[model samples]
Target: MSFPGVRRCHAHRRAPLHAGHRRRTFGGRAGLVLAFALALALGVGGTAAYSALYGSIPTAEAQDRVVVRGGVVRLGTHVYLHANGSHGAIGITRVALVKKCHLRVYLDRQPGDRVVAAVAEEDEAMARLGVQAGISGGIDVVDVRLYRAGRRVCANDRIFGGRSNLWISVTTLARTPRKPATPAPAQPTVPAAPAPPTSSVEPAAAPG
Candidate 1:
């Protein structure tokens, strides 16, 4: 007994209720799944970026030597003393000298590894007060050199030239060791068959 317009209006209202129910059931789950996936991706990406930027920093002891006037003097140095491992950066934090003199510091890397150098001041104070020289990227060997104002000086090699006591301190960031490999499972051992009973009778004297 309802009019045609009223029936149509009732149908339209019921359609919206069914649609809303579907949205509530499926839409929320879909949204949650999408959010979780996004979060996981972001977390993984962040960790990778951090690893790439800063691989690992290694612990090492500092070494020093005296600088004297003579031929060119080269100091062999390393960030990690135990092994020639990978390093991201090397820095000379402080340098102590007995007297003020013109000095130059250089950082040399391996042939294949990335090479980077930190600029040092050209003034003479760099030798006495020390200058910060840092380089980034993987390096195997680092060569350090100390120069007098104009002449190459060898530490402890000459006795007649000006000598300056030098002690240099450095800081570095190096790569860490990889995860240990899992050990293989032990194999089960099989017992050897009992040796055939030794014939103590000597074959009964061969059928005597």
Candidate 2:
């Protein structure tokens, strides 16, 4: 055997080099993972920026307005968005009685203008309509409205929404003058029998 000390030194030098190589390899892989994460974040940011700038609204509209009179209800479809810098829409958001908590509400807007309205799929939609119509009292509880350019555009069916009023609901219902109720038909009465051929009446004389 050559010197024991020399052998030990040689072994220590080789082990450190191997460990350093492994450490460098791990660090390189860690760096790559971090770079990939950054790239993904940047990509998402870019997409958001493009969407905000381009105004790429969905071709399909949200939903139509539910025209009603004086009903404070939940509405979800009419998502008011600011189209131009000057024009904007206001919408009322209320809670619904249904389990899923959809929305019951009233709506009014320009003929083609779309407001945000909630959409239900199967049985949920049916039940919602039933309840909304069933609770058809003329009074609307919540008052909310949407205004554009300082003009009233739409509102909660029962209350004021910021600036607008629930004035357009008249169109959804008929307002005819109520006629007075007619009197009941008179009852017929039977006259009392003339007292059984009146005991006092003289009997007719027999022709003798």
Candidate 3:
């Protein structure tokens, strides 16, 4: 019966919450989502960068080098040959990127059929662009390098003489020319004594 008050809508009422608990809950969930998004973004960005770097994949040829283990490479033994008639050696690209990072290769060419280079046979596009085994223009395309216990091999000075970066050293391994030693100088000769006839004449003049 007293003065009546207007009824309030349920929607207008503030819902109950466990003090700061709701804030913490919301914060935790939001943090998780943000973290996931960040990770995804980083992954995507990384993939994009990689694609851009080696994306311009060339139209590969049917004949290419085979990759073995640990990024070792080898080319067609018959395609790129040495000047001396030796079969072309397998090429080795230290860490060539294939269609994906799924293949492996060993450095040295083993006594068997296998791809020893890091680059895949499917993506051996470099070959089409004049890449091959042997020392082409003073670069070892198919190098025979040496390595340390925990270091990658240097691609220079590995060939018989001056390694080829993308090709073999067609220049055969000739013996380095050794210089001949010169002989010692001869001793000087002594001069002969003066004529005895002059001595006799001079002696007579002195007595007079």
Instruction: Give the TM-scores of the predictions, in the order they appear.
Output: 0.24, 0.18, 0.15
lDDT of 1 by residue, 1-208 (tens): 6686565444444445565466445357686566556656777454444433444312221112111111122222211111124312233222212233223333332233332222222223335534222322223323333455545443322321232233322232222332357899999999999998876654455554
For model 2, what is the C-alpha lDDT against the true structure? 0.34
How high is the lDDT of residue 114 in model 2?
Answer: 25
Candidates sorted on TM-score, descending: 1, 2, 3
Cα lDDT, model 3, residue 23: 52
Candidate 2 shows a clash count of 17
Cα lDDT tens digits, model 3, 111-165, are 4332222222212333333332221121222223323343433322222122222
Per-residue alpha-carbon lDDT of candidate 2 for residues 108-137, written as tens digits (9 for 90 to 100):
323333222222221233233332222221
Error of 1 at 69 (Å): 26
Supply the TM-score for candidate 2.
0.18
lDDT of candidates 1 onward, in order: 0.34, 0.34, 0.33
